[model samples]
Target: MFRNTKMRLGGVNILLLTIVISLIVLYRSTSYCLCKVSPVEEAFGQPMKSQPRPDSGEHRVTCHIPGLESRKQFYQYFTEKEYKCENLRWFGSRDGRKAVCMDMEFYLVPQDCHVLSFGINNEWSFDDKFGAMGCKVYSFDPTMGKADHQRSQNVQFFRLGISNIKGQRKVGMGSRFDFFEVDRYVNILERLGLTNTTIDYLKLDVELSELEFFQDVFRNTPHLLRNIKQIAVELHHGYHGKGLNKTEDITDDSSDMSPISTYQIFWQYFHELRCHGFKLFHARRNGRWTEAVWGNI
Candidate 1:
């Protein structure tokens, strides 16, 4: 009777050990499945989601500008803040002309999307890429020397340029001879019958004219911005040279302002945009220019 009981106890221990090994194997397999990479992530080269570290503070940090003399503080404001976007896709040239965060949550669907590309100086790669995604792209470049026509199935090139003023104005690159005509944002929308339509994306690479264009839009026609979902603009500063002829009537104190003051103005504009519910998602610096993308949340 004692030997039989010993054999039965040994069999029970063996069963328990088998069950433990099976559970360990099952847990490891489940973990592997959970951590598997998705095809979309693999194609886009996006990093796999990992467990957050305890020391890593993945929270948004606010930048406070105390005075205009804080040039270090101004640049720090641009670099310190973090605006998280899950899916960001690049569209345009491999060089600096491309846009970031085009595939953000608000801009998931590319179909029937309207893209206004300002400052396409013969670089159609960005416009063409978005156009191929079923977006109707309107490319503007007064300096391209190309007449207004359909460049592709969905892309349209225009000799028109963006300006604060609605009427014809002479624009040049520090030269008296070379000049072009440009119109206001509101006027262009009215002409294109898009006054009531929502603009999916508005890209501005209009050299140094972006400051004036932004001032006009935010001050004169604040309502126009309500229709725009996303804005990607290359903000130009510290360039006081004569690029585009300034309107003699419109007072632009930017030229008079010191570099620190100019930075303050840019920060103020960005702050105003934030107040209007626009969040800056991505920013890349190329030389002295900073390409910033703000999405209306």
Candidate 2:
């Protein structure tokens, strides 16, 4: 009877050990299945979905201007702080030369208006549109081959380029042409008996000289642009960077000039205009370029 009891107890002990080992194996397998990470999770790694952008101050240590690192950020600042797009009326072609912004107030003006357009690359659609609206438009361009002045119904085309200069200066490598500075052009307008006249609309599309022209205007004749109702300009900064591509490139060869990037200089001039009470209203992107419209309102 003693031997039989011992044999039964031994069998029970072995059965209990087997059950415990099976439970431990099952537990380990389940734990491993839960811990195995998915391929998508492994690739994402950084948790971009859950985290905020570091530049937005959500993850930064200190606060400052966030949108200045890349082109995306630059435009974010342009649209948020610089551009004031409200109740705007887009006119002309969506992708043509006649494109412009005609605010409600300007669109309903009873009296005749005047336009000073710079850099006409053989496209007079904008000038023609304004002229049809009874606005006297003057187009200036030195690249028109001849200095012969041409006139339409209410629009006049002069082979004269606008800039900030003391007198007439010849431009171009060969077959040069004379270009007028801001003061000279204003004086010419005065001589033409348009004294105390306010330019209702100012349009500019100078290939790469727009920055220099702006600097000249601000440094010499800031008041020239003070009363302008609206200003539209196309910026060409897609080449090597922003600002005049040729100017920035040749700056390295010049001695009297500093090595400051043209992009930086452009921002400075642009801010100066803003400080003078010009608020951006529209921005149009054309591939690598951008056209911006500014108004006092």
Candidate 3:
């Protein structure tokens, strides 16, 4: 009986060892393994749902800003935080009595972001709460599968898209958040005379391939950042080891998006956000990590 028990223990050890080795292999081999692809449309040019995503991804962590260790603290995955907020128009507390924090430089969003959906996953939840006191909320997902309209109560949705660039490759992605490049979004806002409006909250959940679109915005549209008191940006790293097909091979087009991994693009952008005076106060790794930060300056 003792021999048999020892044999069982040995088997369990071996199983654990195998599992650890597999995880290490996958992590090193894959660029951003946590991120996934849409089976329906690899580029997801159609509306899958209508939930406004404050930033991106499903997993997140939240803590009372100016938190006290006397209480307790820990991390939870695949869970959500109640976007408790008063209308942005009201002169009230920002986060909760305290703010949700990140680990970076420490920039907390001044307003609540109730995301309805992002990219192809459009039917999630901003379903819980709607707006903040003294704040106006809007969603710019091209994945809405429409032109212009109101999606939810106090929620204005727009479908104008950037695709890739001004004259780069275009998609049938009329409104389904199927495009890349973010400069066009800025251009649209500029034209609307809303460029100067303070965006207490904003989210960018576009796939990793278009991460450069954000870098371009911070570089060229620094003024736009002034309006955004806080941002829930989702910076995807790699394409989960999935190699992208070259445009030249697929369509022989010279003005196609130069294929690059999401990691290369997003890492550069993260550095850019840092230089802009925002700091990270919270971050959690789910399929992807969703973090909350606030501005120090």
Candidate 4:
């Protein structure tokens, strides 16, 4: 009897040791390697020989290149400044919404809030200059109140989230919402009768959990992810969403959000952005909510 009990305890210890080793191996294996930079990555770096900085003190490029990419140039310009958010200024802001500050890199305009925020968060406010460049903003918040959002001769707003994906249940305020949607943001653009539209810049702060919606739906629609000339993403972990439901192997790191740590989801998202012509020009200092910009910075 004594011998049998000892054997059982030893076996349990060995099995636990094996499980620990397996987890360690799995954790080390998922690290990602950066891909070859896109054409945008290449073009962003060449010396800006022809275009000079504007005298108005605002930095913006309106030139169109058939495959024009200048991410490297943007990198060199900002790297010289040590990737500090305060020193960089290419995007503009009119209201609080379009401020393009150290954290939120966007055009700010509080007066025309609905142009981007569909009145879901009364706390949501954009200064008078957000989306002034005619970027159509949508929200699917069912709690959105009815209001007349007038165009400033350029901007457009919608009272629903970009329900571009059709047939997905719109759960708002503990109820179901419905609308036949498209697979991409561009589809939402088309459904809203803006088929020939183009989004020059895009901001997605829809909670880090919405990555699965992006994976299942946004990715399918080529234009929404690819069309935007600029992006500002807020990375978060342990924010539950669709991808987690599908992948049981998903890691939860709420206790730690460091990139050098368990950063598989972060890696996958950034990898997708880089593949789609976004190359990091500038990112905030470590552990802060970074507002990194890619494209013709």
Q: Name the top TM-score candidate.
A: 1
Ranking by TM-score: 1, 2, 3, 4
Query: Higher TM-score: candidate 2 or 3?
Result: 2
Which regions of candidate 1 fall more than 4 Å away from where they truly are?
1-67, 94-96, 102-104, 170-177, 243-261
User: Residue 252 in model 1: shift from native, Å?
Assistant: 23
Off by over 4 Å in 4: 1-87, 90-120, 123-127, 131-143, 151-154, 167-184, 193-196, 216-219, 240-263, 284-291
Name the lDDT of candidate 1: 0.71
Weakest 10 consecutive residues of candidate 2 by summed lDDT = 58-67
Whole-model lDDT values for every prediction:
0.71, 0.59, 0.42, 0.41
Residues 1-297, model 3: lDDT tens digits? 999999999999999999999999988888544546433224335432333333223321122232212101112211333232222221113221112223232233335432222232353233113343213445555545666566555556565444334433333311322343233545556554565554544445544424445654554344445455545544443233334422233232222223353433444454455565555443434364344433433
Q: How many Å off is the CA of 159 in candidate 4?
A: 1.9
Q: TM-scores of the models, in the given order?
A: 0.68, 0.61, 0.47, 0.45
Per-residue lDDT over 1-297 for candidate 1, one digit per residue giving the tens place of the 0 to 100 score: 999999999999999999999999999878866665544345436533343322222322244434544445556656754467677777877443665564445664668788899988677788888899998888898887789999989998889888887556665434532557888887788778788778988998877667768776665556567678888888774454464334322244433245334455677778767766688888888777788888888
Q: What is the lDDT for 224 in model 4?
A: 43
lDDT by residue for model 2 over 1-297, one digit each (tens)?
999999999999999999999999999888845654433335435221222223222221231222223344345545654544445654445443534455564463524788878776777777777777888888877777756465787888776665555345544322333344333444445544554566778887776567657865565345556557788877765345332233444334332123354444555556666766677767767776778777755
Q: Please rank every candidate by lDDT, starting with the best.
A: 1, 2, 3, 4
> Over the full model, what C-alpha lDDT does candidate 4 score relative to the true structure?
0.41
